[model samples]
Target: MAEILAFAGSNSSTSINYELVKYTASLIENHKVQTLDMARYPFPMYSADEEKQKGFSNSLIEFKGYIQQSQGLILSVNEHNGNPSGYFKNLLDWLSRLERRFLEDTTVFLMAASPGKRGGIGAMGVVQDILPRFGAEIASTFSLPSFGQVFANGEIIDQTLKEQHSEALDIFLQKLN
Candidate 1:
């Protein structure tokens, strides 16, 4: 079984993306999944000067270590004004500086969820474009729209969305195996 690292893009304690990812993680059988909270990794805003002066923080190093140890990634990103959240973008920046190929040799299962009708597809699109540069091979993508209406008790409630989510996840797991 492959080591899979899962995490959501937001730092919010009540992030809907986190809830979605957590539920998705539970659905995986046979694989070893490690889910993380971005709040646990508090990196300073990325800047050339910050890198030159202090180098990477312990939290960033630990986060990168998880990536290095994992062969697969399950990521759920939140949106901010039709773009990936700034917190997530900044984390990517810091990790990229630490190592340009942070996600090298790993396949990513990308996902997003939002209360809105579009879900977080805008953020998902931005992430889809960016992660490959860090060496992530995107395996599949899923978006759960209207999170409150569709998800409950750590499961996808809507039958159609559940089927779609299952298919996407099955494809990703198949690629990993």
Candidate 2:
């Protein structure tokens, strides 16, 4: 089984993206999947001055270590005004500072979800473009639109969405080996 790391990009306590990560992690019981709570690993705002002053924190090192140990990632990102949340973007900045290719050789099962009709497509588009800069290869992608209407009770309620999720998961798993 692949060593998979899963996390949502939002720090909100009631994050719907977190729900999406949890649900996706559940479907891959056969794999050794580790889930991270982003709220617990919050990093300071990224700035060149801060980097020069303090260097990488222990939490940042630990987070980068997790990515290094994983063969695959199941990341669900949240959108804020058509871009990824600032919190997640900050974390990525720190991770990159530690090593530009911190996610080197990792296969990512990218995901995004939103309560809006477009899901988190805008943020997903940006993420899809940037993750490769950190050495992550896109394995597959799944987006959940109108999250409240389609997902609930710890699962995807809509049949068509459920099938699409399964297919995406399958594509990701195939790349692990």
Task: Please give the CA lDDT of all the candidate structures.
Answer: 0.94, 0.94
Q: What's the true lDDT of residue 38 in model 2? A: 87
In TM-score terms, candidate 1 sits at 0.98
Model 1 regions more than 4 Å off: none
lDDT by residue (tens digit), candidate 2, 1-177: 789999999999889999999999999966899999888887889999999999889999999999999999999999999999999899999998899999899999999999999999999999999999999999999999999999989999999999999999999999997
lDDT of 1 by residue, 1-177 (tens): 999999999999999999988988999999999999887777789999989999989988989999999999999999999999989999999999889989999999999999999999999999999999999999999999999999998899999999999999999999999
- Each candidate's number of clashing pairs is 0, 0
TM-score of 2: 0.98
Model 2 alpha-carbon drift over 4 Å, by segment: none
Q: What would the TM-scores of all predictions be? A: 0.98, 0.98
